[model samples]
Each structure stands twice: as C-alpha cells, then as structure tokens.
Target chain A: MSSHPLDTALKLAPSASAAGHYTGQSSPAYWNMVGPFGGTTAATLLEAVLRHPDLLGEPLSLTVNYAGAVSAGEFEVQAQPVRTNRSTQHWVITQLQKDADGQPVVCTTATAVTAARRETWSVSDAPMPQVPPPEEVPRLDLARAVEWINRYEMRPVAGVIPQQWDGSGDSSLSQLWMRDQPPRPLDFCALAAMADIFFPRVWLRRATRVPAGTVSITTYFHVGLAELAATGPGYLLGQARAQEFRNGFFDQTAQLWNQAGQLLVSTHQVVYFKE
Target chain B: MSSHPLDTALKLAPSASAAGHYTGQSSPAYWNMVGPFGGTTAATLLEAVLRHPDLLGEPLSLTVNYAGAVSAGEFEVQAQPVRTNRSTQHWVITQLQKDADGQPVVCTTATAVTAARRETWSVSDAPMPQVPPPEEVPRLDLARAVEWINRYEMRPVAGVIPQQWDGSGDSSLSQLWMRDQPPRPLDFCALAAMADIFFPRVWLRRATRVPAGTVSITTYFHVGLAELAATGPGYLLGQARAQEFRNGFFDQTAQLWNQAGQLLVSTHQVVYFKE
Candidate 1:
C-alpha cells in the first residue's frame, strides 16, 4: 500500500543523539497562500507528541501558537514531557527554523495534555446542526487556487466561504461537512488539523479578506481511540463562528462532530487581521 | 492609597541576577478549595510577562496549562521571549516548584502573544444577552467555603451555581455579572482572571460537584487598553457553556462582555472531572 500524502507530509525522522528532537521537511502538497497551512503544522506538532516514547494516554487538549513565519524548507521539532502525574502528562513542543543569519528561531510553540480516560457520565450541550448529508451537498471547487483546499472535500451548509468576500454580511457562523480527499481513517492528528480548517472569522463577517492569520489555536479532544475508529473514513460536521472582531484581533470558536452526532473536538483560535 | 488584593496577589519581584526570572508568593486571599485559584495563577503568569524588560505590546492570546499542583508558598516563574517579530512577540513562561528532593517540577506552562494593535475592520457577531442590571442581581454568597469567592462579586443570570446543584438541569449555559470586589479598575490581568471565574460546565450541567479541575485554559483578548479602561471597575457580563462532556473530561467556552455590550475576552478550557 502507498503512503498517504498527509502521512508523507508529516513524517519525521529522529535525531541520532537527541531523544525528543526530530527533523521534518515541508510539503508543497499542503502549502497555503504563504508557507504551509496552519492546520498541517498543528497536526505535525501533535504527531511529534504522539510518537514520543514517554507519551501518556491520548491527547486531552492541545494549543498551538504561530509565533513566526515558517519558511518552506527543512525544520526541527523538539517535544518533551514537562510533567507527568499518575495518569496525566504535560508536554511542551517547539518548531524551530533557522533564519538567514543561521540562528534558530522558534516558529511555533504547543502544549498538550494527555491522560488516560475512564468511563463517566457523558453529556453534549451543543446539539448537532440539522443539515443535509454530505452526499446531497456539493463540494467546494477550490482545488485550482489553494493547494491545501484540494487535500480535503468541503461542503458548506451555512454561511458563505471566504472566497465569496463581498463585504455585506453580519453573521460569521459557518457550518460545513469536511473530510480528507482520499478518505483516510479519522484519528487525533487529523482531528487536530481539521479544527483549524475554517476560514478566518473576519473574512466571513466582514466579507473582505484583509491580511489575516491565526496567531494561536487551542483544541480539546472529547473522544478516545474507539470513538475515532468508529468514525472511519467519513465526513465530519464542522461549525465555526466569531464572537468578536476588534482591535486587530478576533476569536473563532469551532466544533467538529461525527455523522453519529458524537462531538470529537472543540477548538478556539485567535486570529490577527488588518484593514 | 492601598493596593488591591488582586494586585498584591499578582505582584512579582524581579530577580536581581536573572533577567527573565522572578519570585512570587501566593496569596491566601485568592486561595481556592485546595491551593491558589487557577485564575489568579494565570494572572500572575501574565503579570510576569508584563513586568519583563523585553515586553512588547498588549496580549493578543494566552494559554495556561495546569501541569501540577501549585503549593501555597513562594514559587519561581521564568518568562522568556522565544520569538520576536517586528509587530509580534511570543513568550513561554513556566511556573517551577522544587520537590522534596530539590528537583524542579513544572507546575504551570504558559504561552503569551503580544502585539501592537493597528486600525482594522472590526465587527462583533455575538450579541450580549439581555440581563438585569448589577443592582437588581443578588450576589452569590459562598465566602465561607471558597476564599477566592470573597475576592469577587458574582451574580448569575443563567445557570445555577454549584452550591445549589440539585441535578435537575440538562443545560450547561451560565451567564453572570462579575467584577473584582471593592470595584478595582479593569485591566488585562483582571480580565484574564475573570475569564476563568465561571464554574466548570459539568457542575452546571450535571448538578453534581465531582472532582473537577481545569487542566488547560486559553484566552484571547479582543479589546485593547482603552476599551478595558472604559469598562473601569464596572460589572462585566460573563457567559460560559460546555460543548461536550465525555470520558472523565469536559470543555468550557466563555466570553466576557462589558456593560455596554462590548466583548472583551474569549476563553476556552478543558476540565478533568470524575463521575
């Protein structure tokens, strides 16, 4: 069997001397307008943690900070378990890139909490949105312009896409169906990436694509391996909206749910935007 | 003029020798059921960044990870700018505690993004909920059980407080009016703490207070100094709800809005809870 493009993009090689350090090369297949897509970078960092020797249980929460520009080239990642309790573990991961001066600069910083989950009384307050099935919705046709957009099939059920920026909308909510183009099995890494796949909230609310980028994003996973495997290679409903957009920044809150109405992840991100 | 209890609790003395390290002593006034309240700990961490010599503009985003227990005593904090761009700066701050064996253990890890705000197209999609004025709302009386409760006055407008938990509600929403006791002026540090003031969503949804604690929290500040100052010791509206609760964990998303219906901060957190 051939390797998935995403797997090939996120594949990391360990350093011979360092235990928690890794080297990975950027992939043009997942390229965004600038550098690489933020979602792919988030997935790669979580992948580092998942592949760590000292990793504990599954990821409960993950936060990624896009500190600097990630140049398209080879980069290094350092993942370490900063603290470990009986059942929970905390990790700090950093993505480093060498500048023109050959000095290593931190491009991204992430903190992940992993713990062994136990059976408990479960409740979901945010009900799944009533929308048509993926088979009925038409896929967005952006495979020609955005490389990353081609990696996934997106079908919008509510709100307009960012490309349709006409500067006339007040609502920033977007509900859609999304999944890998090639139908890869659902997992924590892919879910982390999917959490960031929404367009900037400002773009949806203002209808103008001013300079905007996500400064930081946080995702909380509410499912385990069994639940994820049950999802298989299918579309997951995604909903995102902005609460406020002001003073050069805005916050986007989103949720990803499986077809079975199981909430997989809840994510929040702060984006930097300019007029 | 005397300093406010919150200001005193967040105050840190810079180390004469170390550039980015500081010493802080936890305050009993802000103590929770166990040690210091997680909100105050988050504020102290942000305070360290604010006091740093190399500090940049206001905070755009902040993520705090509760890695371990924060003992009630003096602790050390290290805040360093890992990446500095022309318009943005990224910092990594860690709260360190020495174990009985004198080895350093990571208690909390935080990442902060600070940047200069420029003119931008701003819009708020979330409308502030209509609630009674602060004078009309009665303050929750829980000063005897939680010391931190005494530091702030909270008036619930939506969900029931944990003390009133009778396991009767299926909704996890909570909207309340909150402000520092004695009416202290509003600022980023205060807003940061206020973001986490809401009770865990599980407590409101299940109506039972099991063993629950915040594992990680991320807050995005949408307003600048002027907007915060305009809020000026006045009561701010806080709204929080859980998206999903499953397998020993739950996630809370919250927002803080001024009396004028201006949104100030958006926050999200994952909590560890037992059945």
Candidate 2:
C-alpha cells in the first residue's frame, strides 16, 4: 500500500533534544495560489498536538491564527501541553521558519483543547438542512486551478460558485457534499481541515473575485473518536454563509454533518479582504 | 461625573519594567458565581492590546481560551504584538496569577488581530430578526443571583430563561435587548464583553442547571470604530442558540445588532457541561 498524499503532507518528525518540537515540510500537492492551503496548515498544526505524548483525549476545540504566510520549505512546530486537568488538557502551538537573515519567523499560532468525552444527555438543536443525498447529486466539475482543489470530491447542491464575475451575485450561502478524493477515514485532523474547505464568502456573495484570505479560524468538534470512526469515509454535508461584510472584513460560519445527519463540527472564520 | 463600573472593572495599569505587561484587579461589580465574569476578562485582555503604544488599528477578531478558572484577585496580563503587516497586526496575550506556591499559573490564552479598516463594498445578508422594539419590551426582572446580572438590563423576547426545571425546553434560541445599567457608550471593549453576555445554553435547554461554563470563545467584529461610536449607549439586540450538545460539551453562536438593525459582531463558543 502507498501512503496517501495527506498522510505524506502531515508526517512530522520529533526533535531528539526538544520535547515538543517537530519538523515538517510543505507539500506541493496541497499548494494554493499563495501558499499551502490554510486547511492543510490547520490540519498540520492540530496533528502536531494530536500526536503529543501527553495528549488527554480527542480534540474538543481548535483555534488557528494565520499570522503570516508559510513559505514552501521546512518549518518547525512547537506544541506545548500548557495545562492538564483530570479530564481536559490545553495546548499552545506555534509554526516557525527561519528568514533569509536566519531570524525566526512566526507563520502561525494555535490553541487546542482535548478532553475525555463521556456519554451524557445529547441533543442537536440545529438539524441538518434538508438536501439531496450525495448519490443523487452530480460531482462538481469546476476547473481545478489550485492544486488543493483536486484533493476533494465536491458535489455542490445550492449556492454554487458564480459562473460569471459580473458583480450581480446576491447570496453568500453554499451547501455541498464533500469527501476526500481517495476516501480516507474521518479523523480529528481530517475533520479540522474539512471545516475550512469552503470558498471565501465575499467571492460567493459578489460576482467580482476580490482578494481575500482567512485571518483566523475556530472549530468545535461535536463528537468523539468513536463517532468519527463510525462515520468511516462517508461524505459530509457542509453549509456556510456570511452574516455581514463591512470595513474590509467579514466572518463565515460553517457546519459539517455526517452521512447519518449527526453534527460533527462547526467552524467560524474571519477573512481580510481588499476592495 | 464618576467613572462607570464597567470602566472601573476594566481598568489596567501598565508595568513600567515590561513593554506589554499590565496589572489589573477583579472587580466586585462584575463577579460571577465562581469568578469575575468571562466577558470582563475578555474585554480586559483586548483593552490591554488596544492600550499598547504600538497598536495599529481597531480589533478585527479575538479568540480567548479559558484554560482554567480565574480566582478573584490581582492578575498580570502579557499582550505581545507577534506579527505586523501593512494593514493588519497579530497579537498573542496571556493572563497569569501566582499559585499557592507562588508560581505563575496560566488562566487564559488569546490571539487577536487589529486591522486598519478601509471603506469597501459591503452587504448585510442576515438581517436582524423581526421582534418588538426595545422600547416596547418590558425590562426583565429575574433574581440577580450572580453579581454580573445586575450590571446589564436585559429584556428577553423569546426563549427566555426556563420558568421551571422540568426539562421542557424545546428550543435553545434566545433573543433579547440589552444595555449596560449605567448606559456606557458602545466601543470595542464594551462590545466584546456584550458579545458573551448570554447564559449557558445547557441551562436554557434543560430545566436542570447542570454545571456549565465556557471553555473557549471567538468574536469577530464586523463594523469599525466609527460605527461603534455612532451607536453610542443605545441598546443592542442579541440572539444566541446552541447548535448541538453532545458528550460533555456544546457550542453556541450569537450575533449583536445595533438599534438601527446593523450587524456589529458575531461570536462563537464551546462550553463544558456536566451530565
């Protein structure tokens, strides 16, 4: 069996001297217009913490801050388990690369919480939006300009990407069914990346493709490891929309539901846009 | 005129020795059942960054992780500007206090982005929910068990706090009109605090007030400083609801709109709950 591109992209090696330091390289397969896809970077950061020796349990929440763009080369990640309680653990992570002058550059910063989940009274207030099954929807056949777009099989249901950039767009909402191209089993790391797979809301709301990138993203995992394992490699229903866009900034809120209509993760991101 | 209690609670004194370190004390006016209100803590952290000499612009987004419960006493906050771009600045902040053995303890970790906002193409997709105006609604008169409740006057319209703990709550949605008791002008700090001024959804969903508290919260400010100044001290509309509650955690998303029905901020949080 060959290693999946995602697995190869996320592979990390621990430093012998430092406890929390690990080194990894950016993959050309996940390259975006500017840098590696933000979702891939987010997944790599969470993977660093998930592989920590002192990890408590599954991830409950993860926040990734893209302080600066990552260069295509080797980078070091420091994932420190700052605090650990009986049932929960807190981690602080940083991705750093050396500049031309040999000074350390901060590419990203993140915080994650891991907890030992226990069964309790569970309820889902927001049910999955009614949409056609993935089998009925046709696969999206857009021109994959960015390399990262080829890694996912997307079936857009509503609010599809505007075909013409004529500045006549009205809605920012997008609902779709998506899964890994090679059908990898769902896990915390993959789920974190999938949470950010949607296009920028500004691009969807307006016909013009203004320059926009996410500044920060936060994802809350709604289920434990068992639920994710049960989900297998099935497609997830994703829906995202922007509430307001003003002053060169807008926020997008998104949700992912499993094939069984179980809410898996809900993520929010604020993007910086230029007029 | 004397200073408003909200301002008094957020007062910070910069340390002469450290560049980005400040000292502050918890205020009795905003005390919760366990510690000082989380909203006040968030506001204080943001205020520290806003007060920095090298501060660039207004806050665009903020994420605060409650690593541990804060005690009622003096705490030190370290707010560092880790990265600075042409129109945006990234900040990392931490709150610390001495433990029983006089060692520093981490209570909270946060990341914020401040941007020099410029005029841009904007839109409001999610309009304010239709409801009675603040003038027509009666002021809510619930018992003030927590001291923080007395600081804000809330007029709930729908999905108000449960009248009985019979687990009859079929909806976790809550809509209300709220303002500071002394009517402090709306600003980034006040708006950040107001974004979190909602009860835990678990308690609202079920009659039994099982122990619940916020673990992490991220707020995205959609408007600029000028709009907040224009809002003045008028009441703002707030709506919040739980998307799902499973295992030992649940996530809540909320929005705040001014009296003119302009969306100001949208916030999200994950809470830890006991069965």
Candidate 3:
C-alpha cells in the first residue's frame, strides 16, 4: 500500500501523539501511501493545529505554503483561530482531500507567536560537536534517499558511518544525535521535518550529480524557539562548500544542534538551476 | 510604510481582468514587484486562475508553498479552480488577513497546475555561457544595495559581480548576464523577483560577514520554459555549495537563464539557519 503508509508514518511510536493525525487516528501506518511530502504535509498539519483544545500548549510558529499534492488517501484537517492576543495566537489550516480531488488543498498556513517567559532571558548558544554512540553507529539504508528524512530518528556518531560498504563515501562534517524516534514533542514542526533532511549533503561533498530544478529554498526565523523534546538525543553538526554554479543560481548553508548544546536551528537553500 | 498594504499587495497590480491574462500589457514592473521579492503581496490568487482567458501558452508543473509572515499591511486574494482536466488545469490560491478582529488569517496558499504542450520531449540542449559584453558589464551599484534589481535592467555575463570583495572578492562560481536595463520585460512575476538574490552569495563566499534570515527554504518548479524577455540583456547565474547541515536542514542548487540558452524557470527554498 504505497510502502505501507510510509511505514506507518515512519514507525517510532511509543506515544508521540501516538502517530496521530494522518487522519482517522493514524496507524494504518499513516494511511500507507501515494504522495505525502512537502515536509510530510507540513508535519501532518502541525499535528492538526496542535490538536486544538484551543491549541493545547500553544507556543507555535507555524508557516506552511506547500501548495498541493498530498495524495495518499483519507485526508481531513481543520484549525482556526484567526487572531487572538494576550501575546499571540493565530492559526488556519485546511487540507481536506488527500487528492485526486475531494477538493480542498492549502497544505500549509501556520503562524505562531507567543511571548511571556522571563526569569531573566538572553542566552544564545549552539556550537558543540564532539560525538559517538547511538548504539555505536550504523543504520542508514539510503533507500528513496531517506525519503525526505525518514520521519526522524537518526543515530550515527562512531567513526562516522554510511561509507557505503567501505568504498569510504568520504563523509565528515560531523555531529549526530537526532530524535523523534517515537517520543514526539519537538515542534516548529520538527524543524519542518528536519529541513527535508539536507539532501544527502548534495552528493556527499564533491562527487557531483547536478540537475534538479533550480533548487530554491528560504527559511528565516529571527528568534522564536520551543518544541523539541524527543528527550535526550539530537544534534547535527555538518558543513559543505561550493559557492558557485553560475547563472541560474544554486546556493547553500547549514547548522543544527541539540544533545544538550542548546543551539538548535539554522538552515539554508537556493536551488533552481534548470535547463 | 513599515511594510504592509497586504505587504503591498504581494507587489501590487491586478485588474484588466488581471492584466488581460499574462500575454499582453504587463509591467508596472509586472504590476509592481513580482520580482525582487521582499514583503510583496498578491499572486497566491493562482495568477487569476492559471492565466485564465482560457489558459495561455500551456506547460505546467508547479510548486509554491510560502506559509506565513506575509505581512506589511492590508490583504485580500482568494482564487479558485481545484480541478479542470482535459489535459490539465488545477488552481488554488489564498492570501487573507483579519487578525485585528475581522477574523480570517490564512496569509499565503498555493497550488497550480496547467498542462498541454506537445513535444514528445526528452530534455536538455544546454548551451548559453560565454560571459562579458552586456554593454561591457559594470553597473551593480545600488547605493550599497537595492535598486530594486536595478529596475529590471540586469547585466551580468559576469559584470558588477562580487561573491566576495573587500578589495574585490570573487570566490569561485559567478555568472551574470542580465537584461531589461531599460529594454523592459522581465517576465513571470520577475522570477519571484530574483528569488531572494540569495544574499550576494552569502556575502561573497565568506570573505566574511554573514547574516540573512539564518535559513530554511525549499523550492522546486522543474520545467516551464519561456516568458523571460529582458528585451535585450538578461541572465542570472549564482551558484553555491556547502553540503548539508544535519537536523536543522540545509541544501542548495541554483540556476536562471535568458540570453537565449533558454532554460527559463527554476526555484527552490528552505532557509532559517540562525548562527
């Protein structure tokens, strides 16, 4: 069933919203399959607008504009708040037909603004890479090139892996410890589902494959954090360089953290080189 | 103008039945800012039903999801047509605002589809790359930056180029052959106004100074040739590579052409990597 509803919305479920909101209380293994990315439908509509009970814990900063193509089957979601202020609370979501046409696709439209938590405030940090462990590294099938980031849960740190059976794929720009293996609670839509899992370091640094739509991307959020708690593991320190493809535009930049480093967010994009 | 009027109507201009459906009399700079992006508004109205006048020039494969922030002031654009097949034609666009109490707050919604363009097709002819001589280069000044992309009169077969320059840096890949230096016609909402001209190649490839919305951008618009008539000179090729940064998400790919090598449409985004 299209790869078993994406492996039941990517396994790892002890109780992370119990893998809910693929609609109909999840678990047919997430309706099993057809077309579900644009960051997994904006992280399943931010868990359907944070399971609104007037938006439970709040603290949202949702922004989705992945217009069209959800197609897997069984779809329906709704979140509405228009506007509210004590600090900030705005929401609007509507998906409706997983597509072929039940008709109703917006896919993503998020806005979360909340402020009022001061014991003192003012502390910016993230720069701590020195790793190892995750059951001693090893496990990255690479199939479907990790399907826009196999719905989270990655582990690799020991002598760094994925050298693809020893041919040594030349991988190093270290830092690993990611979460969502099943706990769920990390928000900002799991950093928009791990920013579409950095497309295999654009051909593992200098191997060259080139050609995939001008690749244009943008993510800018001044300072608004909170919603990351698979609890205990998550860190990704990496780097890459190629600053020029010329004339049609191709760009890059990256940084991510959380293993207890306390600086968890940074990204880059500009891919649109079509011929 | 702190920046709002529905963020300046996504860059204003609509009517004449939306500029007589994209094939004639266009340009107040494409009715004001459809290129050179930064707080502009309107056009999530699926470009008035995929350029309806019964669809023009035919060729479709689209993607646009810019979920929220969409604010500068005053907004309204709805656009519909979820299905229309016979080859194809799909549409959905929403950009709303009410917040202060009026209610609705959807701000940015997209979904576009339109087909029919027989070629039997295979792809790629490539060509176009021999820099120099757009009136002999040199004209990228902008009082320090921002002449609104020099009002569509671009000229870069590598002139006015500077990926890094203190004394004048050019770190690797740089291709510029721009158009409309008065010749007019930038076409297709001016390619989303140069899709965030990507911070001058992240400040001339780190010859130092980095700051542009941290990061998180995702864009994919495969193929849809033509519609770029800088009239005389036009070409923008700025490429970069700094292989993927884990967890937080980072990736790059860039390209945009017109000086006749052809390859007209391409764009991808996923940015917001705060460092």
Candidate 4:
C-alpha cells in the first residue's frame, strides 16, 4: 500500500530541548474551517506518547482538550510519562505555539493511560447497530466539503444529513460507515482520528447549521493491537448521539465498531454551539 | 443546614507562590480502599480551578488522571488558565507530591473547559431509566464498606451487587439513586463525586471482587451553576454500564439525572482490574 498523506502530515521529529518532546508542522491538506482538523490533532498528540521510549502497553483511555487555536505553523509537543506502575503508565502531553504577541501559549492538553493486559472475563453490552452492508450504501459526495472532510469516506446509515432535515425529529442520533479515504493500516492513530470523525450533533438535529465545534473529547479504546491488526483497513461502523443539549453546549457519545461486530473505541465530547 | 464534611474535605488555601496555586490537605473521612477516594480527589482538582481568582463561567467538562497514589498528608495543586476565549476558558491542573527520593511527582493531572452559556436550542436524548422512585427504593447499608461509601446514600436500581450476584448474567449494568449522606446541597463538587461513586463494573458482572480501580475519568456537565443550585439536596438518579470488558481493563459510561428527568452530567471512565 502507498503511504497516505495523513502519515506525512502527522510526522514529528525529536526536539533539541527535551528527550520526550518533538516538533511537528501543520498541513494544508487537513485544514478545517477554523484550524487543522481536530481528529489529526488528537492523532498527533496520541502519536507523541506512542513514540515515547518509556511507553508501556496500549492506550486504554485518552482525553484531549482544545485549549486554543492553532495557526498554520510549527508547534512543539512535550509528552512525559508522569508515573509508571507495575502494569500501567500515565502520560501528560501539551501542544505549544507562539501567540501573535510572541508569547508561548498552550493550544492543547491531553492525558492518556497505557496498561498491559491479561486475559479475563469479557463481555460487550452495546450491540452493533443494524445497517445495510457497505456495498449497498452510497458514499457521501463531499466534493465541496472542507479538506479534512475529504479525507474520510462516509456513508450515512441512520439519521438524515443536515441538508436533508425535514424538521420532524428531536433526537440527534447518527450512524455511518466510515474509513480512511485511501485506506490506511488500522492502528492507534487511525482509530483516534476516527473517534472524532463524526459531525457535531447540532447539525444532525437542526436544519440550519449554526457555528459548532468540539471543546473537549475523551475516548476509551476497547481492543488491543492484535484485534486492530485483524480488522485491517476495512470499513468500521460508527455511531453517535447527543445525550443532552443545554444552553450553548451539548454532549456527544459515540462508538466505533469493527466489521466483525467487535467494539474498538468509544468516545465522548462536549461541543459549543450558537443559535 | 450545617456544613457537610465533603465541603471541609475539599477546602483549599491559597498558595503564596503563584496566583492560581493552592495547598490542600487530604481528609481521612474520604479514604478509599487504596489511598484517598478518586472522587474526592477529582472534586478537589475541580475545586482548585473553580477557586481560581480569574475563574470564568461554569465547568462544561473535566478529565482527571490518577497518575499515582496520593498520601494522606499535604499536596500542592496548580490550576492555570491556559487559554481564555470570548465565551470559553481552558484550564490545566496538576497535583504534586514528594516521592520517596524527595523529587516532585505528579499524582493527578486534569484538564477542564469552562464557558459562559446563552439560551439556545436544547434537547435530551438519553431518557431517564424506568425505576422506582428514590423514596421507594431502599438505601444500601454499607457499615462494612469503605470509608467513602459512607459519604453517600446509594440505592441500587439495576444489576445485582457483587454479593447478590447469582452467577447467571454476563452483562454489567448498574443503576442507582444517590446523594450526599447528610443531604448536602447539589453543586459541582458533589456531582463530580457522585460520578465516581459507582462500584467498579467488574465487580457487578463477576461474583468475585477482584482488585479494581479507575485509572481515568472524564465528566461532561450539562447544567450551569443556577441549575445545580436549584436542584438543591435532592436525590439524583445515576446509571452506569460497561460497553466492552476485555483483558485486565474495562470502560464504564454513566449518566446523572435530576428528579425532573433532566440529564445533569454524562461521564466515562476506564478502569484497571485483575483476576
């Protein structure tokens, strides 16, 4: 398989100042309406930790906070292993950039937990949603969409798109079959990117698309490396729904499932919106 | 009403070193099986941010990473406002302690997003689970439970407790009605504590109570300050379920709702467990 643009965009090199710190540059290919795609940013942050020499096991949970805007420039990331237990390790990461005033500012903050796994009692309560096979569904045509939107091939399986809303539904539930446009190997970075691939819930509930963006997102990975490699580059089922929308903020919870009906990642995020 | 112990436990004194720094002492009344209860530590971290001199709006989301065990003595916390936008502000908090070698260690790391709210389109999709009212349900007797379990009055509504497990079910789901034991007023601290009050999901699914604890927890608060105060000391319904459990870890997604069937907070956590 050919190398994907995402790999090049997320590439990072060691920084001279710190051992676990690295410097990365943004790519125009993944630009969103405001800044770089949140998914790619999340993926890059996770990458910083995954590349750490002291890293242990796989990612169990990751939380990312979009503290500030990211301009099109170079940014420095510091990933540190705060504590490492016998079977688990915790990490803290920060993405820093110079503000217009030339002062250092934090643009993003993340915490991730990595732990070794042992076979134990297992079960899945959330069942995979019933949807037509990927071959039967039509791929979303995003010729005029943002550069980041064009990076994913999405096919809606449930709920109507914003433009197709008839103003009849009160719930903001959406299910789609999505994967990397140019099929990349399944790994932590790709799965992290897919966790934030869902559109804001507000767009699914309201006909008019008001300004909305995710403020904070937390994802819990269920599968390990073996399961991810088994799934390969096939399409994964994705589902998202809003639990509550109050005032100017709403909370969205989503799940990404492999084609074999195994849950891979579950994510939750709070978004800001305007009427 | 008199002051609740929870308030005294979460109280903080300003640190002389920095504007957003504080010195806090852990309370023995809230100790868990390990060190301090994770919920109280989470509440203390949020308290640090809420008590900041330059605080803005209410908390929309908070994620806390339990990096290491916190001793029962004293700890230093630094809560910095990393970024403040027009309507939103982001904070990064860290709890520091001295290790055996007298070096500074990070016991917990957290990121929170606070924002001002304006009236907008609102809806709730996750309906309150059907169960007996708080008055109808019997409060659990935890005379032999951990010190922290005595801090709240919890009444189970779904899934059997570990002792009640008949070795017949495979799914892990638990719903309960809970609140402060002495009827403390509803606020962000108490609500944050309640989010982690549920027993580990592994205990609920398996008859054996293995060693388990939360590694990371992220909560999204849907209501503002006024709504929290208006709800007062009333009982709040809480429900938690595991989506997938494998290896030595599992993830639990939970929700807290008011008596009016309004969703107040949605939380997710990844737990560490051993057989």
Clash count list over all predictions: 0, 0, 107, 0
Model 1: residues >4 Å from true position, as ranges?
A162-164, B162-165
DockQ of 3: 0.02
Single out the weakest 10-residue window by summed lDDT for candidate 1 chain B.
Answer: B160-169
Candidate 2 CA-lDDT value: 0.92
> Per-candidate DockQ versus the true complex?
0.87, 0.85, 0.02, 0.81
Candidate 2 backbone collisions, by pair: none
Q: Write the per-residue lDDT of candidate 3 for residues A1-275, one digit (tens) a residue.
A: 23433334433222233222335323333221335545455555655655555653333234444334455445555555544444344554555554445545544343332222222212332345555545566644545542434545666542233444433333323345555544354555555555544443333333344443312223322233442544333543333222233333334444555555544444444333332
Which segments of candidate 3 are over 4 A away from where they belong? A1-5, A8-73, A76-95, A98-176, A179-275, B1-198, B206-275
Better of 1 and 2 by TM-score: 2
Q: What are the iRMS values of all candidates?
A: 0.9, 0.8, 11.2, 1.2
Q: In model 4, which regions exceed 4 Å deviation?
A: B164-166
Q: TM-score of candidate 4's chain B against its reference?
A: 0.96
- Cα error, candidate 2, residue B259 (Å): 0.2
Candidate 2 per-residue C-alpha lDDT over B66-132 given as tens digits, one digit per residue, 9 for 90 to 100: 8888898899999999889888898989999889999999899899999999998989987999999
DockQ of 4: 0.81
Q: State the TM-score of the second chain for every model.
A: 0.97, 0.98, 0.32, 0.96
Sort by DockQ, top down from the best: 1, 2, 4, 3
Of candidates 4 and 3, the better by lDDT: 4
lDDT of 2 at B47: 95
lDDT tens readout by residue for model 3, B1-275:
35422223234345344432221112222232222233122233434444555663332323343344544445555555444544444454555556678886764554444444333212232334566555777656555444445454444444234444463433424465544335434444345444435443333433434333312223323234433433233555533332222222233334555555445544434332323
